[model samples]
Target: MNKQQILRNRPVGVPDEKTWELIETEIPEVGDGEMLIRNKFISMDPAMRGWINDARSYIPPVKLDDVMRAGAVGEVMESKNDKFKKGDFVFGMGGVQQYKLTDGKGFYKVDPSMAPLETYTGTIGMPGMTAYFGLLDVGELKEGDVVLVSGAAGAVGSVVGQIAKIKNCTVIGIAGGPQKCNYIKKELGFDHAIDYKNENVRRKIHEYCPDGIDVYFDNVGGDILDHALTALKKKARVVICGAISQYNSTDGMKGPSNYMSLLVNGAKMEGFVIFHFADRYSEALQALGRWVAEGKIKTEETVIEGIENFRDTFLKLFSGDKRGKLVLKV
Candidate 1:
């Protein structure tokens, strides 16, 4: 039997148990061109909240009663596909389930020997790819750039800051607490960390980037993004990543009041979906894989032990209860 979390309802505020229900069904049969994967780790991200909305966006929303969409790494248990063999490790949009059966449309082989399987679902998978394209390509990061990153202890934001440092940029990170702030500074080697929960965000940013910021990698949007705008250098780039702060608002999303600062400073704010760079994934994977192997990039994952705990684990994204990647181990 396979246990899958099916979307029960579209959420208005924060998602809760009512949003999805776990149900068991027979293990699916692999067809002539299909494979069956027993999911090992299911990625829980802030972006999952956006995926459940019944609204137009970059990707189609997860339909009600369908499996809750997610990225996962697993081992192939049965396969009739020529491209995949039983026991091969793979990564794909496996959703929040104990097993997946597919024709391998978006799936690809992964090497567990290269890194841990769960790490692929985090740093070496979608979140890592997102950080690579969001910062280097969209932010146009350069050496000596003063980079500001919000949600710096979370999956995508964490990678963004580290890659900035690797590129010879001075990186400042914004996280929710002293512990997370210290994690970024002490563990991740960020030049400075602002504890957004305890400090005055604007003042701390001004203190850290006294002159101006060259790149701002935004993950937790809303007020922090507005404050970041006020400190942009001339021709600065703002990479608009996930907006965790506004994803669950019943009142509506907040727009930055300081957006005009972009015009004043001749800076640019751009948004992108990682799927647009699908063709270049190998570039990111190779670089991230190399950095991980060289000790230049570090990964921290909080693994919850069951598919049934999906909702509880997912809420960690908004509550700041977990640092780094949050995943459900099946």
Candidate 2:
């Protein structure tokens, strides 16, 4: 039997227990050119909330009663495909399930020896790709640029800060709590860390980037985005990755009221979907792998066991309880 978590209802603000339903279903036999994956890890991300909404977005919404949309890493228990063989570890959009039966589309073989399977969901995976392309390409980063990243201790934001440092930029990271701030600054090698929970965010940003921000990588958009906008230099760029802060807003998204700073400073803000850089994934992965090997970038992930406890595990994304990438071990 395969236990699959399916979207039971469209959530309004925060997803409740009724929003997802887990059921045991008969595992299908592998057919010709097909493979059966015994999922080992499931990725928990803030974007999962937008996926269940009954609205138009970058990708189609997860249909009602369908398996919840997610990125997972697993081992191929059985395979009939020429490209993949049995026992091969792979990463794909395997969703939130104990097992996945796929025809091998949208799947890629991953080297578990290179990094832990959960790192596939964090550092070298979609979140990593998003940070790689979002900062260098969309943000048009230059060496020595004063770069600021929100959610700096998160899966995506952490990578952004590290990459900025590698490119020889002054990196300032904004995170909640003293622990997370210290993690980014001391462990991740960020030039500065702003504890939004305790510090005056705007004042700290001013003190850190007195020369003005050249590039702002926004992961937790809201007041922090406004703060960054206010600190933008002439010809600055803002990369909009994910807005975790406004993901579950009951009222509405809080867009930057300080957007006028862009015009005054002759700066620009652009949003990107990671899929847009699909063709260059291999390139990004190679660079990320090299950085990991050289100890230039570190992978931070929190793993929780059991697919049955997915609800509580996923809640950690919004509750500010988990660090780095939150992965569920199946």
| Pairs clashing within candidate 2 | none
Task: Evaluate model 1: give its lDDT.
Answer: 0.93
**Number of backbone collisions per candidate:** 0, 0
Number of clashes found in candidate 2: 0
lDDT of 1 by residue, 1-330 (tens): 999999999988988778999999999888899999999999897888999999999889999999999999999999999999999999999999999999999999999889989899889888999999999999998998999999999889899999999999999999998999999999999999999999999999999999999999999889999999999999999999878899999999998999998999999999999999999999999999999999999998999898888899998888999988998999
Candidate 1 matches the true fold with a TM-score of 0.99
Number of residue pairs clashing in candidate 1, backbone atoms closer than 3 angstroms, sequence gap of 3 or more or interchain = 0
- For model 1, the stretches where C-alpha displacement exceeds 4 angstroms are none
TM, every model: 0.99, 0.99
* Per-residue C-alpha lDDT of model 2 across residues 112-145, encoded as one tens digit per residue: 8999999999999988988999999999999999
